[model samples]
Target: MRESLKVQPHHLERDAYLYIRQSSMRQVVENVESTKRQYALRGRATALGWRDEQIIVVDNDQGESGASAAWREGFQRLVSDVGMGRAGIVMGLEVSRLARNNADWQRLLEICALADTLILDEDGVYDPTSFNDRLLLGLKGTMSEAELHVIKARLRGGILNKVRRGEYRCTLPTGLIYDQSGNVRLDPDTQVSETIAHFFDTFSRVGSACQTVKAFRKDGLLFPSRLRNSQTTVFRPLTASTANAS
Candidate 1:
């Protein structure tokens, strides 16, 4: 089998770290091909002369965002291992999979450069120690970050445009909901509507959320709570926080 010249004997002697991540749980569930492609990098690592047992997969951050490394345990561990000379090369589907934040990406590159560790992606292997490779990697990181920013900006613009046209569909409060025509209206349920009206009236009289909750408890009244991902509403004992939120 042909091997990359960058994969030296010393590099093959060390473990290969395969870092896998997806931006969100929804993407993790729906973007199966991307995840598979990332896992398939193990084959690439083996082809490069690293043994299967020596390829370490750091996937704890699978459903976590790449925006920052502070909250990603897998990324933190990968960086720590690379810094400690435990990793010969770091493998990812791409630079964006590793990190979207330039600071985070740069930190990892610096650590890898210092440790003489190589980085591999679908494009090719990159040696952070080499000036050309490092420059290219830095550009990739910047573009990844810019891509995220552009996506957010586009989404924000679309939402703003919808709002300007009074067409933005947002979740309503407990006492209101979208009708069949997508217009916001008071809940049709008499009990729910009356209860919410009473809550507001009580709050106005009591002048405190805790007192309103106390009054509801005293009257043995239940507050309507909409269950997540379901159209059904449930009535339960009210708390000060819920009353205040309403």
Candidate 2:
């Protein structure tokens, strides 16, 4: 049997994972250029003699801030792959591709070291096994951390701009409507809406959801569905009978 190749030239076994991301709106909306840049990474993998099947390339089309590892699905999966021994080599444009946050970058580099994977950057190929490469990784991770700070400031400014427009920024409750003409109006033809109001009034009348349910039940009211959670999304309580009903 042929000798099993170690990370050195004698060893030829390598499974490559390519992580591709375009973090800004400018990068996302530019269909042609962004894709070509990403595909170039694939071409790079091919040049290294990695088969199409052996190379894993993942793409995310979101304005999602990569500064924090908490929000990136692709990054999380890549980390998991490295940890699980699936990825023998990890390739990306820069350390920022792994994380913008300092903590995530440190943790990922450590994991790659422990798992014995090769990390490739444009500057050089990093093997955590070597002390010099580890130092380089630490420096790159620090730079990524700084880049994240700038991205956060820009995002916070944009959110404040939205709030300044008097648009209710968060989730809206049922009775309110943001109409076609950009007006916040109350919905008029809501039957469940009226019933829901009555349920709330009953809650105020009885002082508890249980008492509301009991009193409504005493009045032969119908409930749509029962839920036990505090943040229950479904509510179907019967409304007061109209006096005009024959």
Candidate 3:
């Protein structure tokens, strides 16, 4: 495979990096196939003559956005290694995994070109220094960036439409919930409703959130709160911030 792709002896001397990333935590959890495919690039590297020791998988950026590379430590490390002439080939599932920002993608391209590093994806192998390969990679980067914009715009438009129709549902903090028809309504629990109503009424009378919390604590009452991981209600001391938010 290395011979077919023109992988030279010098290119095999340094490390081969398998860079992996996902746009968000939800994708990291739901898109198992994509993540597995990216890791499988390790086998491709080995088949290209790089030994197991020479392969490095940078996966710290999982569950991170590729729209920018500023906060991606894994990408930073990959670029640093390439710039320092420690990487022979940088591989990813695709260009989007490297970066969805053109600036970051171009910067990586420049570094790889200068360091004589190869870039590999499922499509094929590419030498950044080569004009044809560089041009194709540049186009991929631009398309990736544009794709991100298109997705954002589409999602934003849908959300705005939903909001206009009063259907833009969000998680209710407490004392409220969506009915079967998706309309917002107060919680069905009588005790929960009374507690929340009393909290608001007390706060209104005291004219201070801090005072309301103090009154609740003085009365030895446990403030009701919704558990994060479950719908079950729990009782705890009222926090000033929670009081204010309510």
What's the lDDT for all of these models? 0.92, 0.67, 0.91
Name model 1 segments beyond 4 Å from true.
1-3, 181-183, 186-246
lDDT by residue (tens digit), candidate 3, 1-246: 543465888999999999999988889999999998999999888888999998999999999999988899999999999999999999999989999999999999999999999999899899999999999999999999999999999999999999999889767888887789987888899888898889989988999999999999999877789897567888889999998898
Better of 1 and 3 by lDDT: 1
Range of the 10 consecutive residues with the lowest summed lDDT in candidate 2: 1-10
Which has the greatest TM-score? 1
Ranking by TM-score: 1, 3, 2
For model 2, the stretches where C-alpha displacement exceeds 4 angstroms are 1-7, 22-32, 60-73, 122-124, 158-174, 177-246
TM match of model 3 to true structure: 0.74
Listed in order, each prediction's TM-score against the native is 0.79, 0.59, 0.74
List where candidate 3 sits over 4 angstroms from the true fold.
1-5, 172-246
Q: How accurate is candidate 3 locally (lDDT)?
A: 0.91
Top model number, lDDT: 1
Residues 1-246 of candidate 2 have per-residue lDDT tens digits of 011122443112556888877776666777556556656776655555567788888666256667677878888888898898777677787777556788888888888888788777555567776698889899888888887777779988888888898753554455555577767676554654676577778777877666666787788765433243222335454333321110
